[model samples]
Target: MFPLSTSINLTLPIEDPILKFLLILVIILAAPLILNKLKIPYLLGLIIAGAVIGPHGLNLVLRDSSIILSGTAGLLYIMFLSGLDMDMSDFKHNSWRSLVFGLYTFCVPLGLGILAGHYLLGFPLYSSILLAGLFASQTLIAYPIVSKLGIARDKSVTISVGGTVITDTLALLLLTIIVGMATGNVDDHFWWRLTLSVVLCIVVIAVLFPLLAHWFFKHVSDNISQYIFVLALVFLGAYLAQLAGLEPIIGAFLSGLALNRLIPRTSPLMNRIEFVGHAIFIPFFLIGVGMLIDYRAFFRDWESIEVAAVMILLITAAKYIAAFLTQKTFRLSKDQRTVIFGLSSAHVAATLAAVMVGYNVILGYTPEGEPIRLLNESVLNGTILMILATCTISTFATQRGAHNIAMGNAQESDDDRSRRPEEHILIPVANERSAEELVAMSIMLKKPRDPNGLYALNAIDNRVEDPNVEKRARKILDAAASAAAGSDIYLQTLLRYDVNISNAIVSVARERNITDIVMGMHHMTPAVPGIAGIPVPAGPAIGRMAADVLGHSNITTFLYNAEQPLSTVKRHLIVVPEKAEKEAGFQMWMNRIHQLARNSGAKIIVFAPASTMPYLRTFGRRRPANIDFVVFEQWDDLPSLEHDLRQDDCLWFVMSRRERVSYHPAMSRIPLYLEQYFAGYSYVLLYPVQAGPGDSRYL
Candidate 1:
C-alpha cells in the first residue's frame, strides 16, 4: 500500500487514503523506536526522516493529499498536548525565579531583536516592533523532554522546569500585548486595554473554567471522552483568545491549566493522551517542521545567515548577563546562575509559530509575487534554522552544563567527608519493640565489622550526670557481651557535657574505625547531628546511628537492643557454579562463619550443588578442619542427607549462587525455594556474587 517503488506502485494499484494513512502511521511508529535505538534525539530523527520522504528529498510521498491534512492535524494535536504538559503547580513552586528570569529573557531578546531589525536590516519601526515581539517568544515544552530524559530525580531539573512554565506564560502575555500594539490597532489606550483584557481573562478563568472543570471531572468517566473534552477545550480556548484579539495558543494553555487542577491525580486520561501524543502527533509535527525547510534559501541569503548568527550570540549573551546579574544580586550560587541561563536557552515551537505569524499575517511578508520575495524567504527560512539550532543546542548543552555546575558544587570536600556520618546511632530507650529492633539491627548490620572489631558504646546524659546512668548502661553492656560470647567486643563510656549523645557516639566511631555500633534508645540532647554528627536527646537514636554508620568503608551495621538475642544468623559459603571468589561481602560473611565454627569447636559441613566444584577449590587453602563439604546432584535429594547432618550435630550450611538478572544472578530461585523448607534446622545462604561493579545490585 505504501508508494515504495514505481514497479510495485504501477503493478499493485492501491487505495490512496489507506496508503497515505499507512505511510504516515509507519513513519510515526517506526521513527522513535529506530532513532531511540541509535541514541539520537527522536525529534531530530523524525525531521530528517520527513525531509528524506518529502518531495524535495527522496520524493517517496506527496504532501498534496491526506498526508498534508494529517500533518497539520498532528501539529495542532502536539500543541494541545504541549499545553496540557504545562503544569501550573510547577509555576507556583518557582514563581519568584520564573518571574525574574522570564522577564529578563523576554526583555533582553526583544531589545536585541529591535537592534537587529532596525539597525542591522533597516526595517520600518512598526514592522521592527512586530519582529522583536516574535523573536522574544520562547516556548519550553519541558515536561516531555524531562520525562524522556528521566531526570526528574534531579532537583535542578525540577526547579528549572518549574521556572520555565512561569517564564513561558509571562513571556506569551507580554508578546500578545506587544504584537497587539505593533499591529497599530490600539491608540494611546494600549496599556489600559491590555490591563483590562488580562484582568478580565483572569477573572473569567478564575470563576468559570475552574468551577466547570471541577464539576465535569468529579462526575466524568475519565476515559476517551475525557480526552476528547480536553481536546475540544483546547480549540475553544484558542477560539476565545482569537475573539479577545490575543493569540489562540494562550487560551489553549489556560484551558490546560484549568483541566490540570480539575483532573484527578491518578486519571487514566493523562496516560491515554500521552500515549497518542507521544506515539504519533509529536514525532509527526517535528518531522513536518524539518520537511518544510528550504535549504537553498538558507544558503543563498548570506546576509540573513550572518544576521541570524549575530542574533543568536547576542540573545545568548544577554540571557547569561541577565542570569549573572540576577544571581549575583540575589546572592545565588554559581550553580543556580548556570541553571537560570540554561532555562533561559529554551527557544522553540512557540518562537517559530510567532515568527511565522508575524512575517505572514501581520507584516505581509510572503515568498510570492515580484522580486522573488527574498526578504520574506530569508526571515521564514532563517527563523526555522534558528529555532532548530537554538532548541537542540540549548536543551542538550544546558542539561550538561547545569549538571556539571550542580555536581561541582555538590562534591564533598575532605572537611565534608570528615563530617559525614558512618553509622546510624541508636539511642538506648525502653520500649515494647526494643528487642525486635535490636534483632533487626543485628541482621541488617551483618556486614563484617572493622578489623579492630565492634566498639560497644554508651553516653552519659548531660541533664542528670547521674553515676547510676553509667551503672545501668554497664549492666546492659555486660548482658550484650555475654550474649555475643565468642565474638570480639569492646566496651567504652563517654562523659558528656551539653553535646548530643548521638553526635558523640558517631564522632567516636569514625575516629576509632568502629565497624558496627549498638546504643540505647533515649534522647538526652537537643543538638541534631550535622552532616557528621548524630541526633541528640531522645528515643533510641536509631536514625542518627544509621546515618553515622552508613557510608564509611564497606562496614554494614546492626542496631539492636541490649535485651534481645541475635536472630537467624545464616552465613552461607556460596560456591559459584563454575567461578571463584566474587563479592567481597560474600567472602567476608563465609570467612567469619568458618572462623566462628572453628573457634567454637562446632563441626560445619558445606552441602553444595555438584556444579560448584571449580569455585570450591579457592576455599581449600584456609579451610577449617572441623568443616567438611559434599556436593549434591539434585535439590529434591538434599533433604534426605540434610536430616543425617542434623542428627550428627553438624551444622549444614547450604550455599547457592544465583545467575544474572539486573545485577542479580539468574538461577537464584533454586536456593531461595530450598531455603524455605529448611527454615530452622539448616542455615541456607543465597549469595548472588556480583560479577563486577556493574553488577552491584547483587551486593
Candidate 2:
C-alpha cells in the first residue's frame, strides 16, 4: 500500500456544486463496494457514509436543496419500485394472510405506542395517538436487500410487500385524521370529504392509470420514451394522492399496483427501470436519510436516550410479536417469520412523515416559552436514532433470513439433478424492429437465470468485401443485445464473415452447442425458377436462409413473423401435426409455447389430431384448463383456418423435415401455403429437433 500524503491541501466543508456532486458519486460508488467484503450490508455503508460526510458530521457537504430533491425522488422511486416489482401471483395467493399480517403489525405497535405515550411518557390524547401512528407505520427500507438477493418473489417477501400496502395506508390515514382533530378540522363534512376523496383516488390510480398505460404501450415502442411515461405516471399518482389527502409515497405504490400486469418481469423496460432507480435515485435517498443523523444528541442528553430506547423497544418488540402471530396463523416456517419481521420492523417513510407532521403541528406554548408541539425536540431527536438503529437491524435480519431460505432452496434443487439440460438460444436478428420483438420473445422462451444461453448473431457474407459490411452487422447485433440488456440478461453477440451466411450460422450453432435458433421471417433471395414453364412461385414464405437453416440443422428452430408486440397478443393457436406427439422435440416445443402463454396471460387453442390430445393433456397437466382442441387432421384444409387467426392470435404451426417422425407429404408444401394465406398474421413456424443419437435428452 502507498503511504499516506503528509500535506493537507483541501479545506473543510467544500461547497463547489460540481465537486460536491462528484464527491457524493464517489462515496456512492466506493462505500458499498468496500463494505461488501466485510459481509456488512451495503445499505448500512451508504447511511454511515452520509453521516460521516453530512452537515452534522465533518460538513464536507451540506444537506442542501439539491440533495433533498434527489433524496425525495429516490424515496418515491423506491416506493414505486416495490409496487412495480411485487410478485402479484404470490400476493394474490396470500392476500388474506397479508391483510391479517397488516392488521397485526399495525394494531400491536399502535396500541403499545398509545399506552406508552399516555401512561408511561404522560403525553395527552391526540399527542399519544400521533405517537402511536408513527410506530404503526413502517418503511420497506430493506426491500432492496431481498430484491437484490433474488428473493423478492418469495412467499414471505411478497406477503410483506402486500402488508406494507395495508399498514402504511392505514397509518397515513390515521395521521391525517389525528392532525385534523388536533387542529379542530374534524367534522361531519370532513369525514364525507375524506371518504369521497379517497375512493376517487383509488379509482383513478387503479383504473385510469392502467387504461392510460395500455394506450401508451400500444402506441409507443421506444424503451426510453416508455420509461419516461412510467415515471410520469408514478409522480402523477403521487400528486393526485396529495390532492385526495394522502402522501405521495402511497400514490407511488398504488400506481405500481395498477400498472403491474402491463409490465413483464423479463422485459427490457423493467430492466431499465431498476437500473436507473438503483444507480441514482435510491442511493441519493439513502444518503440523505443518513445525513439527518446527529449521533451527538444521543450521547449529550438523557431524555434523547430515554425516548430513543422506549421507541426502539416498543417498535421492535411489537413488530416481532406481529410476525410470530402471522407465522403461527399462516403456518409459515421460522425463516419466513424472521423475514416478515425483518421487512416490517424498519421505521422510515411513513414514520418520518408522521414525525414531521407532528413536530410541525404547534398547538400552543409551554410555561418556559419553548413551543409546545405535538412531539417535542427530545422525541424529534429520538426519531433520528430510531431510524438509524431500526434500519441497521432490518438489514442484518433480512440478509440472514434470505440466506437461509436460499440455501434451503439450493438443497432442494440438488435433489432434482436429473432435470433438463441447460438451454442456449441463438437468435439471428433481421432488423431493429424485428430484433426487439425477437429478443423479447426469446427472453420469455429461455429459462429464467440462464446466464450463458442467450446469443444474438449477425453473419455477414465474406463474398461482399466492403469494409462497411462488418460495421452494419455489428449494429444489428448490438440492437439485439440492447433489447436483452434492458431485461438484465447478457446477450453474447457474434459478427462473423463467411462465404455462405447459412453455413456460417450452422457452424456457429455447432460451436456454441446451441439448443434452439430463432429466425425472423423476411424475403431473402428468391427461390430457384419453379416448374420450367408455370409462373415462378412467389419468394419462399420463410426466408431462403431460414429454410436452409431448418434443413441443414436438426435442432429445434422457430421462424417468427411478428406483426405486433408480443405483449399485445391475446391467444395462441397451436396447429400440431398428426404424428407430432411422437417427435423428439415435442415436449421441448410444448414447454416453450406453454411458457409464452403463461407469461402473456394467453390461452392455447390447439388444432391437432385426436390421437395427439392425450399427450397434450398429460404434458400440460400442471397448467390451468385454458386449452381447447379441435380434430384438425386434414392438412389440405389448413388454409381455410385463416378465419381462426385473429389479429391478436399467434399461430404455432408445427412441421417436420422429410422422413422425420412427424413428417407428412403435405408438410413439404408448407412454404406455398404460408406465403399464400398467412402473410398478414403473427405466427411461429416450429421445426422440432429431429430424433437422432443424442435427441432423447428432451426438456
* Model 2 lDDT-worst window of ten: 529-538
Query: Please, what is the whole-model Cα lDDT of each candidate in the order they appear?
Result: 0.49, 0.82
TM-score for each of the candidates:
0.50, 0.85
Residue 534 displacement in candidate 2 (angstroms): 22
Candidate 1 C-alpha lDDT tens digits along 1-699: 886655434322233656756876788778768977886655566666766776656666655545545555455554455444443433444457656665666677778878877898777665565566555655543334544443332334444544444544555565565556665566768777766776676556556775665456545643556677767776676666556645555666566655653442212355566667777666666666666654555577687686567656766776677667767665776755665566556466566655655555443443763332212555666665666566565555455555565455346333443774343323232233352333223323332221123334555547766767766766655544332332222323233333655556656655676543443333223345432222222322234444443322233232222221122121222223323234444554454444444322233455555555445545644543344566744444444544444321313232222232212232223333333444343332223223444566443
Stretches of model 1 off by over 4 angstroms after superposition: 1-15, 36-38, 61-90, 150-184, 188-196, 319-346, 361-375, 398-699
- How many clashing pairs in candidate 2? 1
Model 1 lDDT vs. the true structure? 0.49
* Superposition TM-score, candidate 1 onto the true structure: 0.50
Error of 1 at 332 (Å): 6.8
lDDT of 2 by residue, 1-699 (tens): 999978654776877777888999999899877998988898888888899999889899889899999988888888888888776655666889889999999999999999998998888999898999889898888888887777777789878888887898899999999999998999999999999999999999999998898778878998789999999999999999889988888899899888776776677777788889889999899999999999898787898899899999999999999999999998999999988999999888788889999999999887998788988877889999999999999888888898899778767556643477677899987577789889888887875545458989888887787978777878888899888887888899988878787888899999999889988875543555322111223455455666677767877898788887876665779888887887888878887876665455455788988888888877767544346677787776778788777766778779876655676666555666776887666888788976753455431
